[model samples]
Target: MAEEQEGSDAGSEEVLLTPAQLIRSLEQAWMNEKFAPELLESKSEVVECVVEQLEHMEENLKRAKGGDLKVSIHRMEVERIRYVLSSYLRCRLRKIEKFFPHVLEKEKTRAEGDPSILSPEEFAFAKEYMANTETHFRNVALKHMPPNLQKVDLLKAVTKPNLDSFVFLRVKERQENILVEPETDEQREYVIDLDEDSQHLIRYKTIAPLVASGAVQLI
Candidate 1:
């Protein structure tokens, strides 16, 4: 069992995760975010915890002898963790950039008290990117258009995530009676059960909720 430690966030209680557990959580988040058609909910808490763990590891490494085998192994482990963190964040940024208008629209209309899909920093980046995009459009194209045609509906123009796209996933928890919609009128919709540790390729829209709930993991 993993040990608990005091959470670093203000108003947060003890976090029930050890360093190993934190790394696993981060890796899971990274993989899910990387493959999902749409941006998933922020895993900022997990990211923060992992960063804290890495910092602690680095501080200890600073005290180790330079040529020690253990130090070299630890350094390699640190680099791998860093790569995962960087790749996870980069994937999110790419999604935000590609769908800034839609992203901002969702943020704007999010229900009060609902968890945000973006981290605070990510939210700020999305807003700034939206602003910059609009400004560039106005300067390069909108400015030359007639007043009636000057306004552009970004939500309509930008491509939204293809939620219907197929994704490969593994079930972490068993789920029964998942309704799978038919692809065509002649085909019949069916229900299926997802057993624990079972893998399948299915439409992302069909299992998006499960992914967000952590019941399933994308491969």
Candidate 2:
């Protein structure tokens, strides 16, 4: 019987609160409503200030409506300019294509024909080409030339035998000698007197048969 009475008492003591009572209870428990009025007023003022700035910006946008600036068709303008440029290029391209065959033929003729037949500009170009080609050909030929031979040796090695009907000898002064100079022509019989005696000088260009046959061999 006592336990039942205690349970009833506990149940009856459990307080029920309305919405206003609950809010009052929370304010008292946490002291939330006791904050300084100055802070709350400053927060409200900042919010109002932001709202006023936004309203001013909105009014400025309304006044400026499509008047404060202008926009250009930049990409379209570029494309149009490119198209105009391409029109001139198209003319040049057609001109080049139209004359391509003649140009090719002229080049071929210039390349193959005698250099003397070309115009001044064409001839100059051809000459340059010829000079370059000749240099290249010479370089290739030089690579093929015998590498170990000196210039003189190469000359001697590469020279062909000379064939001539006439034989001639040159007689020129040797230093201070006043002696008669001996020489030979293509003809057989020619003679010259030696100013110096046999002991004082050397005999040169004495023909073998002429001397043996008692022919004049001083020359």
Top lDDT prediction, candidate number: 1
- Residue 40 accuracy (lDDT) in model 1: 88
* Tens digit of per-residue lDDT, candidate 1, span 1-219: 333433334565665886788889889999999999998888887877777888988999999999999999999999999999999999999999998888888888988755678989999999999888889999999999999998899999899999999999999999999999999999999999999999999999999999988999999
lDDT of each: 0.90, 0.31
- Residue pairs with backbone atoms closer than 3 Å in model 2 (clashes): none
When summed lDDT is taken over every stretch of 10 residues in candidate 1, the lowest stretch is 1-10
Residue 169, candidate 1: alpha-carbon lDDT: 100
Tell me which residue pairs clash in candidate 1. Answer: none
Give the alpha carbon lDDT tens digit for every residue of 124-181 in model 2.
Answer: 4444554564466557675566865312222222222121211222222222323333
TM-score of each: 0.93, 0.16
The clash count of every prediction, one per candidate, is 0, 0
